[model samples]
Target: MKFHPYNLSRERLLDFYKNLLWPRLIEEKMLLLLRQGKISKWFSGIGQEAISVGATMALQQDEWIMPLHRNLGVFTCRNMPLNKLFKQWQGDLDGYTKGRERSFHFGSKEHHICGMISHLGPQLSVADGVALAYKLRKEQKVSLAFTGEGGTSEGEFHEALNVAAVWDLPVIFLVENNGYGLSTPVSEQYRCQQLSDRGKGYGMEAVTIDGNNVLEVYHIIKGIREYCIREQKPYLVECMTFRMRGHEEASGTRYVPKELMEEWAKKDPITNYEEWLVKEGILGNEEITTTRNELKQKIEKELAPNSARLGETYAPVAEEPTSAQSSLDEVYCKEATSTSETAHHGTPSLKVEGTSVRFIDAISSGLRQSLRKHPNLILMGQDIAEYGGVFKITEGFVTEFGKERVRNTPICESAIIGTALGLSLEGFKSMVEMQFADFVTMGFNQIVNNLAKIYYRWGQNADVVIRMPTGAGVGAGPFHSQSNEAWFVHTSGLKVVYPSTPYDAKGLLNAAFNDPNPILYFEHKALYRSITGPVPEEYYTVEIGKANQVQTGVDISIITYGSGVHWAIAYAAEHLDISLDILDLRTLLPIDYEAIRYSVKKTGKVLVLHEDSLTGGIGGEVVAWIAEHCFEWLDAPVMRCASLDTPIPFNTELEQTFLAKARLNDYVQKLIDY
Candidate 1:
């Protein structure tokens, strides 16, 4: 049977042809640039351009698109200026990422397109959040997220589908099954006959279509999009195509079978569509030549030296705003004049004096107060809505704020963070709870790559807080108990906060809510009920970057935070002979260097301690900083006492031995004696 184009008006057919031509020309030009060593890398969608073009054309102008690296057709179909797109490849200052990134790692807020990272699957979850926002706002807009068949194998792929299906969000998951993931063939990637079939497990309608058939792809996507908007339910469409070329220019077709490549080459999407148009008498050969020539000229014009500012290093012409300027620009940026500041100026202050509360209660109170103050605040986590989270810290929140504000999510940590990022982009403050800090590994890519870098890259404040219930001691073994603050502290563009006391937890959470950046707020699980302190009822904010000197002395300085704070204080009190100065570094990322310098200078000895694994913990960074800055003042080498470099054991005695508090005590005493 001969192939025929799907039924469409002549004008629509011609438009699809033009859309296909632009990306085809762009891909050819990009390959030429790659060969000439003008660009660093190129991931060409030579045969699969139809998928991006078709899916993008199906969406409305206001709808969002979270495109992958190969979706240049989507950018073109959206009328992204060819000059800006070329400038991105040339790494020019006028590019979307200001030359900081290359290829498809850039997007425009004006266009409602999200810039994607190398980790492709996380964007699927992010698109879920965008769709969630549309549903919440009662907008008929739907989000389209594109990924490869290989991306479907990622954990985030399943997580995103589950969340979107459960929430009935308006999102279309487009899987461009190009037969191969890099050099690995699809046969080895998955056992399923069709990648879209996995969506059925998540209770969503799924379908597979010929990706090379541009008109069919467009028709199917349009219908799916309409259905999603009408029903506010997600649908997955797998477009089966082939990657004619290698993954990149450098990787030739060495891994692909010559016969398979030859077979797929004949069905090249652009050529096949062009042939159909010509055969059907919709477009003539002369018109096809004219269109190709015009597209080539346009691509060349964009690549012109003057347009790209070539030969000179491109630098940002506009001065980037400082942190203070950014803070002042935020709508939620209001300085707390005093600890007793209320939600409104004229309203009576709700401050309570000497009201003792457990650590968990303090956190819950802070969340409750923040939600009451900000109508746009959203709380999400697994089992948070009814079960009130695993620790019951968010108990009664679903009842008080209603389920719309307090959400229970599926067991999808990456999606939770990614969706929170989506909510934050829409000017909603989202506080996502990681049931346990150990599970943060599941969402690490989204947190570090997407959540952490969003603010710095595009100047968009990701006003999101990731509440990590962390630490050991309660016999929650390896996967459940871990002090993972060090991981986030190592990542730049993230604020790490770990509070030991009830007062600090309540106050710092308020401050985090006000801050216009992503904050990783860690709460020690052991301290949830084991500790209690006076917390004010009114809205109060503890300065994010400041350290509190819990105890004052001049002999030896012990620096700690979270669970370690209690141990250090107890040890200091037990030995009256040692004059100990304990400093609780509530914020790890923005370490109070001045306070550390002052304490080390006065005491002339320093010991940094934490409950995280000893080798790569935050303590190592502290010790390095002290040695670099306060080496002259130090009377002894900076010491550190942390949990042994091993996973937390299930046995109570083994766990106690693993996290030996005596080791910290011995280190502190030795520092004092030295």
Candidate 2:
């Protein structure tokens, strides 16, 4: 609780000095490797070691740290092995990422570190999410997030700070103002004189410090960490430093003036800290030399074995099955004998007497039940708290569950999903509602690059569900009306769920919350109030990755999902002459291949329909699969129908002409006649 630096013991001071030495030596070694063509890239934090090491040392070991690309000191301070770091740099199979990622892109759940991606700004929101989890659990731990001055220019930076301030999350947003964002200087990046000043506008405690002084940075962050934990509020610390070297080894300093570089080099963090240690009598000059020599020896020993094989091609190491994957059978209820007994959270058995509920109400009821059952389940979206979301799916949720559980967020798609990743990492299940599915593109990087790959890359389960309100209807225009389930289906690690009926909406959401992976739950906006069906009041789960036979016929199979299912069923009901088989695909990714094969084989004809655009839609994937697997059974070439490859029009007539449903009857008749 004491904030004075003089109270620190000599042994602890020496340890901080050692933390500085290791990353400095490792960065030099990595640069050497880059020159030798052993490594592809190197982002050095040579002059910026004090900020990373001092801030990391100030936190409790249980607290989380989300480091940017330049924070090699944070990794070393966390005691990540030098051998693993070297192997990762060389892209070896034995590395932390198992050769899947390149330099400095790795995280360890055991170490309480969130690995960073190339996009630098999103991690701030993720760290805030982790801090939010701690606050929710009433833990005293804090989360530290690092980014450079250049990253502060991004929109996510503002969104993250605002959310953390509004929620009073226990997070430390550390901005290492290293003078340059790649080659662009601070003058061009922002008009503000001080980067930390921006944090004050968000109602957070903000400070600026000299990063070259390790003791100053260490003392300030130590106080900041305690302040965050004690007050349960966020703080922003901007440490002004310089990048002595280029962004990477290949990025030259030709753009920077020699005089400025020389001026900053004089205040090198490692040298300044080492001299301070020696002057303070904590370490002698001889001891400093000996420590540096020992670190050099350790680096040489770690890199020796991988030196020769650095550029050699090697197969990527296979990830061992994690608890999430091993427990998939139980989560998905694949082998469960009783659905009611095996439901998540041990909820009561569902009664067969069903009540007719609208699609949106079913989704809300399922979410409410999950929230009541699971203490760790959190619901977040823009205008979701008081306004009950734009669609009123979460109406009265804030009043029922309180704002802490049912939270409102800024209009930031990236932060909503990115922060959910942090919550998932901290053992909380977060359900994020996108105002509309069309806006998902704003968070595409977090979805495709981060959330989708987190589990596959490190065997860490991102147990988060993103609720996507989709499809073109109600004249919401192009921005609001889009059936983008196919975009997520194209991504590998994500599970795509597009349920039509109310029963399927409630059941699938229950299943999605329990599944230990990222799920994109696509609910058709058109069907939110329009569709109603029998839904059990008791909690239950519909198996993901399975198709339901809505109506059985022998002539042809009509494959569809979401709003498309209604069109297919209507066509079948009107024309009783053609015995149509309607197969509604509840889940898109991990498609129901067995069901498709069986239906196509029995009918010997197929018509795949969806509301997505014609090119690169789920229809193409379905048609391709049928051609490959059910080709022999096909009596005719597979027919396909989808919306035109253009933006949804506001005009009702133009919208009808552009939609796939307008031509579904014609396509089904052709498939049957063929």
Candidate 3:
């Protein structure tokens, strides 16, 4: 593990010394770029160039890649068209497709290269999922994910490794130990002597090699990749490299020793290997000089076109063109009809054709029907494969549909979201389930930033159905039980639906699948087992944004959804003399504004309700819409009954007290009396 040296023919070594290779020149130029103010930062793989090149060369052309910031040296050398590369380095629009990504965070669609993201450890999960996809399709390809020792600390890293190891996925995880994380030394960051030892925790085979040796890197990476493909196994390869550059371009002086700079400079891997090549007769003086000079020239030529126009390139923009697509205007549109699972079915409802289905089974059944109707549908998430998902909603999916459609994902929320986006772009109906909707927060980048805005900006329908198991009654507490419906309910371009009954779960799920925009299906974990209604064996669809008027009255409108809807109905049935109109707002954002208007017109009063907090709750929006557009139709001021602005309590008494204090649906009859 200390070092790897090879005895080879001088002629072979000389030929391998193609200094003009894109990577050699890129590292040198990037450092120059930092000095010239072209790029504001540089995280060099200076003494670590060999591992970068070795791992990259070992990958197949079709297999996608996700590399960290420092691996620009390998990425540049991989023939990622220099024009876009320079723009990215210079912070121009063209550098990254959507000027939204960081300069070092770039991807090449032409090369099947995935864009780099900020959460370093999460990319490993993405690569694992990508490799899993290849395996499912029988493609015999592998995806490589690269990160530094520092990133190995992230929980996502462990989750990704565990999934890959347990599934026998075709993925290669590479760790570049540069001995430092920002300013902290590796000794202080990790307890283990070698970072590779961490892989053992996941039951993965680990290989550690000196990163400075180019031939050694090539040898190890080549063999590992071959073994992975031949046996369909995942491997962790740690390259022990050193950094010649500081943590970043701006931190040249924040180090421990005055001699540290000189010490690492003398050990520069590129220089050391070139020298060894010449001394061993593997490379002649002319060949080495020519290769180095040519590499320098090619890089210069590639970067020259953008040196003057740096930061002037076009930015990557999202896909919204019409307000109809941007907002929840597609609640029911002509296009939705064409894409409907049953082209002729209209406004299907909960009919007891005699099937008792669990809430979770309803989700899976709805999905299965949609996928069967539309072959473009694809489902992915952690343990969704043989394990059938943590909740078993995906149980028996792999064997029934096979792996191509049903998949187990690496625990990278962002990567899972990103790959789902890509698959959506390729004309697949991507259905992503957050293992626990609580952890969906980890991929806020993909959800809020990417998935939400794709259709609004691109004018294309990104039909991604994200199912989240939300609510707080299961004793999972805090992290796993936070109610997140309000977060997306307030966001535009999203449809939020909560189905309390299995029958409604199926109908709404089908409607969600038919929607042209992204939908957030929040399933209350408490309802998954207990709340079973009659579900028909045949497929059905509900009209999104259409409220279900459970009761007809003229005194007050008790508007609610999800868990709150049931309480609203129960309260109305118990107090028929109060004359209450129980209205269930099927879709949160598009909202059945017409139904609410009808209720307000009939009763001249309204009582909005929900399980979420009153502060910025969906009820507020409905009340505001009534005030603004249907003010003449109102009789009294709109009233809202919602959860208290406090965390869901673990104690049963406190929870009941919390619900009582908020009065949510319990206040429905009271509001009617008022």
Candidate 4:
């Protein structure tokens, strides 16, 4: 019963029917429940079941699949339990995401399925990463991602296709062109003849197939999957289909013309397939009825209450929270490394031992150490391979680790970051370097929505360290020079680390690599060549969420990080009469409040300093905390010394005037004299 290329027996044909029927029945039941006010909404895949069924059935169980919202057949074909899926759609605690998300928004690691987000295109690039993993490991596995016709318009779609093609990774970009994208007709969506043609633009082989013909889709994709693995190249398959129902049950299809609906209805996949089965002598009418009846019964059994009727109101089992504080507690992972319990009251805690190295070299040394320690560690960014990196941080990495470990990505920031998350999903650690910190805005959605929220949404850890070369000073202008640490510090699931010295830089980088959560490691570009300090040749780690006392004094506290630390040290050297307690905040998100409090209490005067602009900076957060907690100990009003509220100027003189360091003497004098 072999089907030529692969073992698609007669029994497998029957199983495909079952897979198609299951979603059709489930959609009917969900719509009924919606009418009864039991479920909130439903994204029905009434007629598009064949595409998912055929595509999923073609892939191996271990091969990863990134499914869209309409791919219920993908889950069923992968053998996800019907009961748990029902609970997930019902938003019950027993769901895969623990009711954090509803519908097809939850990824199941066990099923090898990565779920979709509201923003549709990121998952496509993530699939490229999964495929890249297979390529890197030389595994004969292909990664598949589902997207609609409208998704092709997304920049990520273009980036994913080009990346996969360039890398010669085994991946299938499946586009389900369902005539319309939520009321916008195909005519309005794109001017191209076929969505598959866009794939050719990326230099990949593309094809269009009849989505309604389940047998055709299954056969084509099965062959394509084999070709991808054999050639280690990407393929784009565009399935032409029509949405038999509205985008969601709530959004009615009033915009769809009656003539078009009537035309598509005559080509119903189930009815047509049943006729083909009967006419070809594969099965009788009775067998078709029997198969449909069994599918209906199975759905009924799964959805029914303990003793209630089949279609009766089935209330989900309620599960209460373990504790009221559990939600807040899980936001950050509990760390093994401990920070300072009590600050060095009036003494500098920094040891300053070992050979002196520049800040950039320390970073390079730490990265080299990490790469040597972990074989799965990947460094991804623009110009990071043979060209090293923008800062030569990975100069000899390609020769040492090869191109598989040191990947040079396209200028698609969003895609590279999403790829990092995908690599993490498949048990690989990644370090993504932004050529300049400003370019991070391109990948902001992936960082905030995907990486930062993945662990919180579905308990999937994103072991990634995004290296940001930031801060103003070399007159790099508005875009290149920016102390943008505050942007990620405001985000919840991310750890922000900013180090000032070579020793701290090397140690903190290693610490960030060791952590399981997503971390933002900010390296000030200005300090790269200028600052030199003692750095150990051996691998070591500095505890995150800790502050270091660089210089100890009793009169005033200069609380800062990055360039501010150097400014404080220089000011202290010149102004010998005034005593300054220079405290460098190594991490921003978990802002070493204990160290700040101890220093403020000891000095009785506080001056928050940073290279970022004054109005909405981390300095404001520090000043607010001081005002709230250490108001009674304050000798004068808590003041902030920060860059003027404007973009970093390109002119050297103007830049110097705009920087907070120019005003540090006046601010420190005022605090010390008070």
Candidate 5:
């Protein structure tokens, strides 16, 4: 049942054995190192080595692989140098998470492998995206994405599979069904008997293979790969494997039931494959003995430390990176470099040329100006093409620049951000629109997990500006009307900016578009048309962390941003009875604590406000920051006048109760009266 011609020759098989040997050792070594407290953590592909080895052996060196965490086997099976792999395990800069990248987060252009994150389902889609790009690029290359069974539970799995099938992409989506997600078993995770059965829904090729059998995995992967190059039809191979260890090194095995372990342990992948190899005359008992000794000797000899760097030895530790360290930004981000040669920092003054410029036109003008200066910039979201976008902000981009630069996505948020990550890795400036701010959460994982974490991991910077039309006064219900900036404000490694005026919008946006990290640029739906201020003719940078002071009053400090700043301004302009000091926070993540302190010290009173529901809104953090930093300076208890904690009710009257401007008058009156 197991003899396959694709299995390597005696010497090559021995080499394959050598290849197969260390990855397991590496995976196990990492597991132990984690227990030993050397590194923080890693995902183990111990039992599924057959697939990584088999599938990798199926491809040529030039083809690219987009691998999930459970892909240590691919490296092992391909006989990638063990020392470098071990160094990577140690979380050293020498390790391939490619320095600054998380340990085990593998990427090597030289190896033609683009390593993936621990996130499960997106690789399936990204593999397709990379393959699509390659096909268009006319490269003789194929892409493979490896994931686990639990990843199949994700909506993106179906989305990617369907799209790849529809487009006939040159991608191989290999699902290594290891029968568990942490402690959850596959049966509980899926209704279908076989994971591969779901592929029929996509109308592409699909098959289930014995994941433990190396030759079976190899031949199946190889055949589909050839089929892909010949027909360009994507393939899906489901490897019904087992999770031989805990999810990661840090996870305790206590959650796993004894019966399940006993069951999986009986089918130990390495042992079963070895027996098969021996019975088929591929190897004798002596060679198997020799291979085991050789592997054990290497494992014992290659002892050091876990590869990943834990979040610092202490919290709030500043990593002071120099300009040279920052120069990694230049070569690392392809998009960042693309337009640098052409980008003019101080863009010449521009007169408003058009006669009938709508609110959306302003948005387009700003984007066009920024794009003109940044050639690596690519804009695509929903109907942002001839449709000019849902808001008509990008109306003529497709016609002007063509689809390659102004693309039309299939409404896949993960792919949008994921592809943007790929582009950003090569220094491209990515401006992704989420259609609306509420939908931004769909792609939030990619932004937070990959884009935001990139700089923290491998020093890979994503100069990406995620623009979203946020806020809810105009009555778009729970699904559409939500002020989600607070969510991003609380996340680390992201810069959140909510600019109020056209001038600040253009200037602050210019600065954000230039920053090295990912930025959530929120444009309140309330301010897009109504709010207007003088935008200077020439491009100028607005400091990201500094807040704008609208007034120098002594009674109270009204703190707000985005549309709320306008409300605060209006409230101040009208009622001079209590000259309340106003502070407009530009960057929420890096909150302007200095401004908060200065204003609190001046007025001895504080009122934190926002249009979002008061419960756990971003105001809470601002209040906490003020309390911690300016407690003694407070006159009255720092007050918070946020919208009542409820969804933006569809009724206009109810909606008014939840808006910052609607309720802000009362707060101002009370402050003045006090």
Candidate 6:
């Protein structure tokens, strides 16, 4: 049977034609510019425009859509201004990402769109987060994400699908099977007869459609969207289509068989749709010609390279950029200046009596208080809800907040982290607890590439806190006892906070939630039960980037944080002759430089201490900074006391030997004598 426009109104049908035609014309213009050496690259959506146009038109304005690299129709269908999009492609400062990115790597919050990163499957999980918010808020909105057939191989694809299916989230996962993933064919990409068939394994309904038929694509998507909102369940839709051009302008199409191209060319979406419209007397050939001409003219006018500052020539490469050009300044939110926000920082405005508590209990108290303050706060992790977490930090949380807020996610780290980003996009706060700090490797891409880079790339705040239960003392081998704080500290955009005492744990936990940036809250597992201190019963937040000066002395300065703080204190108590000034660096990323400078200047000799291995630990960064800035104040060379460069052994005796505390006395005394 021949396809139709789903019986759309005459005006609506004409608008749909424009949506399909505009992207085709724009793609053509982009190719010309690429040949003329204006733009560096182009991902052609030449033949597969209907998938983007049809799928986008089926969704409402308030609903969110995650688009892929070739889905230019998503931007145009949402009514994003052509000039701004063209400026973005030309690397203009007026573009959405301020020329920080190129091509379609940018997303527009105003348009209710989230664009994909180079790693295609992470956005699928991010879309799940958006749908999760809709489910929680009862918004009756569904989120849709687009991916290529090749992207289905990513672990995030399976993770996102299973999480959505298990939770019955209102989301649609659309895989546009454009025949080829780069040069790899569908046969090699996956063994399934079709991409949608894999959805059944995820316990979700699945379907395949004639993607070249715009009306069929629209009809299926619209119905599926309604079904998802009503039932609050996920669905998988695969559109079988073909790309007419190479993957990009530079990649030639020599690998594609000639016969396949000829067959798909005859079934071209635009040409076939135009014939159907004319055959049914929906419009005459003259009208179709007139519309095509108008769209072409509009593309030319909007995409004209009028600015000498943009696209005329690329900027000259600089060996070193000035401070003004550094992205570090703009990536993090400036200190909140409003009276209400400022009041939440430092000490609590209302003084409350203190109670002695275990470090784990203190964390629970802070999280419980924050949940009460922010009713929409969400807590997610494996076995965190009904199971009360492995450490029982959230033992009674599920009873206080329902299952909706206290979510127990699958063993899908990438999806959960990406979902946290999605929650942040909709102005909700979320915290993801890694079962152990070592498992962060499973979600490393989503954390560093997506969460850490979001604010720097597109001016979006990822208001999510990742709780890491770290450090070693128990006989839990190398897997569970890694001190992995340095990995995130080296990453530019994430805020790293490791608190030693119960007071700082509760206070830093509160502050990390209140702050807008993505924060990694590292809780040393060894200190969870072993450490105890007085924590305020009432709500309070310790400043994130400030260090706590535990004690003051003049002989030698010991800078440390987390488990090292406890070790330093024990050593100081034993040695009264050598006066020790101890500084606990609560935050690692935005290291407390001022506090370090003051303590180093006072004592004249310094030792950087941390639980991480000595080779590339945060101690190196501290030592390097002290050498650069406080060289004149030093009485001795700056030294670092850390665990040996080896995995934490499981044996109790070996573990004790592996810890920095075993060698702490020698390192501190050597620095004092120097």
lDDT of 1 by residue, 430-455 (tens): 89998888888988899888887765
Q: Kindly indicate the candidate among 3 and 6 with the higher lDDT.
A: 6
Q: Which candidate is the best by TM-score?
A: 6
Q: Judge candidate 6 against the unseen true structure and give its global Cα lDDT, from 0 to 1.
A: 0.87
- What TM-score quantifies how close candidate 4 is to the native fold? 0.95
The numbered model that scores best in lDDT is: 6
Clashes of 3: 13
Which is better, 2 or 5, measured by TM-score?
2
Q: Write the per-residue lDDT of candidate 4 for residues 1-674, one digit (tens) a residue.
A: 11222456667767777777888988887788788867777898888888999999889999999999999999999999787887787777778877778799879888999999889999998898899888888899999999999998898898889888888989999999999999898899899899898877888999999888788889999989999999999999999888988999888889999999998887777777767667667768899889889888998787764223224454554478555477667776564334222223234675667899899999999999988877889999999999989899999999999988998988889988888888887888899999999999999999988888887777788888999999888989999998888899889899999999898898889888878789999999999999998887888888788888887788899999999999999988998988888999988978889889889988899899998999889999999999999999999999999999998899999999999989988987787667
Model 2 lDDT tens row, 524-630: 98899999888889987888888787777889888889888899888878888998888888899878888888788778989998999999899999999899988
Residue 1's lDDT within candidate 3 is: 22
Q: What is the lDDT of residue 628 in candidate 1?
A: 94
Poorly placed runs, candidate 3 (over 4 Å): 1-21, 27-42, 280-338, 341-361, 370-466, 472-482, 487-495, 501-503, 511-520, 525-536, 540-555, 577-583, 589-604, 620-636, 649-654, 660-674
The models' CA-based lDDT, in order, is: 0.83, 0.84, 0.70, 0.86, 0.71, 0.87
Candidate 1 minimal-lDDT segment of 10 residues: 341-350
Task: Count the clashes in each prediction.
Answer: 0, 0, 13, 0, 21, 0
lDDT ranking of the models: 6, 4, 2, 1, 5, 3
Q: Report the candidate with higher lDDT, 3 versus 5.
A: 5
Q: List the lowest-lDDT window of 10 residues for candidate 2.
A: 341-350
| Model 2 score (lDDT) | 0.84
Query: Model 5, 1-674: lDDT tens per residue?
Result: 35464636777665556666668766665666566555566777777787888889889976777777778876665556766675565545456654455555756656766676777776666576567666656665678988778888887787678767765778888898887888788878999889888878878878999887777777788888888888887888899878776787557578778897788887766777677667768889998778778777776655423222332331111124346655344333333222221111112223432233333445566677777777767776787777877777787877777776676667677767776665554456777888889897778778777777665555557677888888877777776788888787767678888877676676667776677678888887767777655554444556677777766788888888877787787777787777778887867877778778888898887888777788888888888888887888777778788887777788878788767667776776676566
lDDT for predicted candidate 4 compared with the true structure: 0.86
